[model samples]
Target: MARSYSSYIVAQSKRTPCLQNVCQFISDDCRKHDCKIVSLEFFAQDEKPRRTDLDQLNLEALLNTDVCGCQGRLIIVEDLSTAVIETLGSCLDIDPLFFASQIHGPTFDIVSSKPSDAILPSRALSQNFLSVQYQRTVDFGACSSAPRKMLRNSNVPRKIVLLPPIKNRSIGLEQQSCSILLSTTKSKPWLGLILVDKPNSDKYTTSEKQLVLPSTPFQGGYEDFSERPCFFEPDSGSPGRVSLLEDLVYYWEKERPPAFQPDQPTLLSLTYYPLKIAAAEWVSYVAVISHSIKQFEYSTEATFEEHGLRKIDSDLRSLEVWGRRCLQTSSKLQSAISFLKYQINGAPELEEYSLMIRDFEYIADLVTTYGRRLEIMVPVVTSVLQITDTRRSLKEAANVTRLTYLALLFVPLSFVASLFSMNGGVSAHDLTIYFAVALPLCAMVFFVTRLPTFDFVPLGPAFGKFGNWMRKAL
Candidate 1:
């Protein structure tokens, strides 16, 4: 056979007589419906009069109660006393679900009706008959006509009654339509209410606040509810202002990992905003340096032939200036890194900036290394070009001088030969003697022709091999 189940509603009141009357009413209703009354418990502090101490009560009254062989229903009624509300407001840690039922109980199935002329009796009687319970009188003149009925009909307790609206202001209404309402009372420390406004379908629209009571406790620190200090606000002197060095010290003290020691090189990262600015500056400096070096290379290539030595000397000076400037910029970058490191010591997000600075430092070192090589190569190449130019000029001069001397010696010889040939030879022996003399002169001419024209070797073949190798390698 299927077993019958009973529902248990847990409630609390300001006094025991009120609690007993409510329990008796619920029990009578359950008996009329052929359902059994499982159990009912009241939660209240011991210091108050007519209060039941749930902590000292018998556990079996609540634990052994059966409801359809399932977990018995738990209905909690909380009296929102003034003390309870004040205690809840001051506490940061409290469960929000325990007070949800009482705040939302009256609105479970309220029906709309016109304002009535009849007055409700302010008194009631209970089975125990020890005390007469009087309903708390509420002044509806302070409330709007629409919500006044809902408030008057709700008989939960005097302490939990919703207060009437303050004059000149709409009570329980939020400025923003989408905003939620939060409620706190001393009796239930952890509960909060989320009130929403739902659109009405009726032509006669009335402003109604729908309360959303959370069924669970809110889990977070009290600081979560505290407001952060505004940027423009003056400091409250809680702690002194943070300086760059102080910031670094604080991070080094607080956030530095246990494995990290003061002796080890600390890596500081940069925030995106500062890092981007620094990167832009570094890139601009690099571009300027590159342009200056390119100008030097251009000057070197242009005046190499005409102003060979002088142009190279000028280029050397310019390169040195560029190197000095690069060094200066590098120093500035180092200083920036140091400053930013101090600022970003404890900041985890800005760590990348430190890496970027390190990379820029490496680039600066590379530039310095290359600058040294350029210094050496500039003078060497200039000397080689000068020596090559001098050798070419001397070779041309030697060729011209050799041709002039040869012409001077041959011109007279040619004239004498011509004079001797023009005259009739007196005898064969005389002609033979003249021929022998001419033969010796011709032999000397041949010997002079065999002599090298210039002392320096021709540059064409030697330089051609070098040029060809360079082309292939490049």
Candidate 2:
């Protein structure tokens, strides 16, 4: 049976006509094959954290429920479908364009349609509910080292499956889009909704073999080379592909900060922790990319000759790709900072997050620095390649010069010897004449070739006068 997303439309006559149109569009756009919900977690300062099964609970009522004192509730939706998006949009009264951006991945011109009174971050739409959408860089270890045809199979499970526009490309860096929407009121703190675009990881199994293997057969590893030069193994500490929902759940369960007290009146402190975590994760990505760039640069410098020009050229292109991705990530972080600044300045309810503003600024600055470093390193790498080419050219020219000298010395002697060996009257009568002619002729050739080695100080003025005379005559 074919699954039809468009058939499951929920009617909401209470919304504006514009919203209705947006909802209809979302319903139509929902893919028949959609991502399932990963997990549902609710966090409270005093009570133990708990997970709710999707089949047993009512998402609509749960999202709309008023919790004046609870810390926060986080809903993790993976590989978005029309039903989940439609339901969340209706429940939170979120802008339709946000879901639109989710359906159609964020673009360069992702700007809010609203005026400055409600300007949101990149691809975000400001309203009574505040949301920010940003791209998170994924570290695919050696799978992204060099361009190859590995991991192309769709049937194989992957830890992170990017949206249609972002999948299966050698863009130096791979990214997944994540949007965080916070619904708040004057009395209530906020209800957090995080929409992710990765596949659910229920069936994912990580092993020693899996660590060495890429997701698809043609994804990114040499099947033959054990120590593949192209493969870049991510650091064990690096957070390569993390689920924001799962990470939050883990933090709330095991690593919940002692600072979060039950006496706190608002959930503002708990809600934006995910954003902070997101920013911190980017900091890790910048480090990993920078480390990879440095490692490649070192290899090129160490053995430029052994690798040859083609290898160095490929490395240069890879460096440029890394630099570009870093710039993009930095730009996204800057937008997040701007959005937070606006929230802190304008929204009285968000004044508490002023400190988080500094943290984001610091992280953005760090990423920008690494990006600039990669940019600077590109020219240095080019220079090394140029030096290698120059060396090779000089060596080849020297070999040609040696061959020319050998030909000049042997040609005159061979000609004289052949003439003496002839039987006819035209042949040389004696070998002495042959020797006499060949020796002087060889010396003359040598002198002519070595003329540039002599410094003609005595004739310098004469040559200068002659060159001036020719110029005047012309």
Candidate with maximal TM-score: 2
TM-score of 2: 0.63
Q: For model 2, how does the per-residue alpha-carbon lDDT over 298-334 read when each residue is reduced to its tens digit?
A: 4444343656777678778777876776676776677
Clashes of each: 12, 8
Q: What is the TM-score of each candidate against the true structure?
A: 0.29, 0.63
lDDT of 1: 0.33
For model 1 the local lDDT of residue 305 reads 52
Residue 168, candidate 1: Cα error in Å is 81
What's the C-alpha lDDT at position 94 in model 2?
59
For model 1, residues 356-464, the per-residue Cα lDDT tens digits are: 5575566557556656755665676566557656766887899998896667567546755786777776578766767777767765554444444344246655555
